[model samples]
Target: MAAPSPRPAGSYGMDASWVPWLWAAIGIVYLVLAGFSVFSWGAPLWVTFLVAVLGLAFLAGGALFWNASAHGKFLVWRELLDELPAPARVLDLGCGRGAVTIMTAEAFPRADVTGVDLWRSIDQSGNSPAAAEANATVNGVSGRTRFVTGDMTALPQFDGGSFDLVTASLAIHNIHSPLGRRSAIGEAWRVLSPGGRLVIVDISKVDEYIVHLRALGAALTVRRAGWRMWWSGPWMATRILIAAKPGASS
Candidate 1:
């Protein structure tokens, strides 16, 4: 097997190389569509509407396919698992393909990690329980990890204050609407123990994401990964948002 790459500096998590290419391809496709819209001065209304619809379809398709990759999973693992304490109990929301779940088990050897996902047929790729179990065995953390199929908006299997850390990596945007995302966040908040941390890493509406965290009474801190510095720099870089439940004062 190939050796794992060394972690990058000033990074709290794993480096994901494929994200840049995926974003570039999506940007190029949308730019080309916009160019066509400018050039087609006399195009019919329906034609323009069709082009717009197709562009959105392509964007969504690309995002879903990209999210299924191990690289994306690694990114989530890095952002969410890096700061957690040992012997932690972690809940991975929308744990597609169990990449993040398995990685968490391996990285935290002492922690118990549980993954939950909707497991919709369309989004299902190689992230099944069998794959996750095999990965855990290979990584020598089989005792610490497990995966379950479930929805994020309603995590009935988990009781309130059950976990030390709660994470949703690139999964929030998959919800059908803003209200759905909020409900998912609410579920996460409910499952976390007081003083536990919540981490959400995704390309979503920043304002809305922050608003949901605020509504949960969490104190938020945002960090930019080094990989995103080339394009977005410190200002608009891909983010890892960290929030904590209020803890008792000393």
Candidate 2:
């Protein structure tokens, strides 16, 4: 892996990255320009109304993004860790910034967690394996955590049923295509040993994810996560799916 930047544990560590701020900035700029035009050039009243609506929307979007990505994710992951068994081998899919992955390693000293991510720049600012490594090192779990540059749809390094626990935190929804999403779910199921547990958090299409898991003959439960999962209220439509491969104690 490439050397990580010399940042504290939190350097580039926010759950939602620059995108929300960018949207808010755009809205604020629009509002400012519209206000200037209205005062100096006597722009239309509807222009003011439009800018107000758009500006508020953008601000709300930014706030929601912050709540969902940072605080809410921490809460959800903490609770999930409590619910998970003491896994010997853990696989974290789409482990951005090493939040869940490092936390998993920290929580279970016996488990060696492998974090896999495509690390797309669009997903988060400074999202990379090196950033993840830095986060792990800062958290002092670097010994138990490993960052892998790879896709969720195909995990070639890990053999079938190798992981005792699998987790994906707000990561899979970025896969816009239906096929890729299914492949990710299938690959998680395939790589886990029988009775292994899989947990996922996504903004949308988790019902489909649960369906795919059920089709694989795994026992599963789906919940519309509470406010702890999404601080923007329930309208944001966040969901969590917990599934387990058969032949293990439930």
Q: Per-residue lDDT for 65 in model 2? A: 71
Number of clashing pairs per prediction, in order: 1, 3
For 21-125, candidate 2 gives per-residue lDDT tens digits of: 786897798778778868886879898778778877777777777776656677677767887789999999988788888778877988999999988877766
Error of 2 at 198 (Å): 0.4
Candidate with maximal TM-score: 2
Backbone clash pairs for candidate 2 read 161-191, 161-192, 161-193
- Which of the numbered candidates is closest to the native, going by highest lDDT? 2
lDDT of 1 by residue, 1-250 (tens): 9966422111112123355456557755765775577576766767766766666655654454344242443554565566666537999897765666666776777789998877653444444566656666666666887888888998888999888888776678778788888888899989988888888876545567789889889999986544422222223334677778886310
